[model samples]
Target: MEIFELDKEQWKDFKLHFKWSSDKYYKVDIRKTQTGLMVELKLQTTDKPIVKDYEEPLWQQWMDEESDDEAQIFGVKIDSEIVGWMTVGMESWNNRLRVYELLVLEGYRRRGIGKLLLDKAKQIARQKNCRAIILETQTNNVNAIEFYKKQGFEFDGLDITAYHNDDVERNEVRIEMVCRNF
Candidate 1:
């Protein structure tokens, strides 16, 4: 397998599609305290494996004009077939590199493809003098969370209502992970 940078045209034609299954998720719990609010995330097991499938264009059309973030796309290809890719962007306002997206095909997972892509993102961050590398994943995506943790990321913060008002109830709270050492 070979990893390389993808041009705009090539990225435009690239579609990110992947499926994931998880038997565990982080349960978000929030409570009001005298001083402030208290937040907790507990690892919980699901009765059955939660599966998710997604298929979408590399870049959202709405983000084209409104987004001021500068990004680059890199893909992993094997024998002319693209199996995984990552979109890393520079947030000038924050002076950090954000991983906008990262996906590896189901069959290509566990082969260091995701790590390779993330390593590339770190390299870019260092080259650009970024303060850190940050990305988001759902609490229900335990596998992804574990992967990020293994790569030296820690839970920096979380949004209880990022996707919807009942995101916590839905067990899909948005988790912001950061690798500051990068």
Candidate 2:
């Protein structure tokens, strides 16, 4: 597989697909102590699998809203076909790189494409003198969580209401992960 900066002509043909199912989720517990607030993460498992998918693909919407000048997208190509892609942007105000999207085709997963994308993001961030690389993943995405951890990311924060009104009920809390060192 070859990794390259996404070309304009190659962007439209690549379909974005990120579908996942997991039986494990991180449960959040917040407590208040005299010094400060403490947040705990517990791994919880379910007998049945929990599936997650976009209501509609996000590529078109992202293309519409995010200008090419603002976001840098890297694509993994195999025989001229894009099998994986990652989008990242430098948040100047925060002095960090924000990873907006990272996805590999279902068949292309577990082959280091995601890691290559992340490595590209880190390289870009270092060039820009950013402090960290940040991204968000759902609590139910255990695979992604594990992968991020293996990639040297740590749990930075949590948003209990990041998604819909029933995010907590749906077991889809948004968990923020960050890699501070290159």
Candidate 2 clashing pairs? none
Q: Candidate 2, residues 64-149: lDDT per residue as tens digits? A: 35433477678899898888888777677678888888898888889999999999988988888889999999889999999999
TM-score of 1: 0.93
- Collision pairs in model 1: none
Model 2 / residue 93 / CA error / Å: 0.4
lDDT tens readout by residue for model 1, 15-105: 7886799999999999999999989999999999989888867765443343345467888998999889887777777887888789998
Candidate 1 backbone overlaps, count: 0
* 128 Cα displacement, candidate 2 (Å): 0.7
Report how far off residue 123 is in candidate 1 (Å). Answer: 0.5
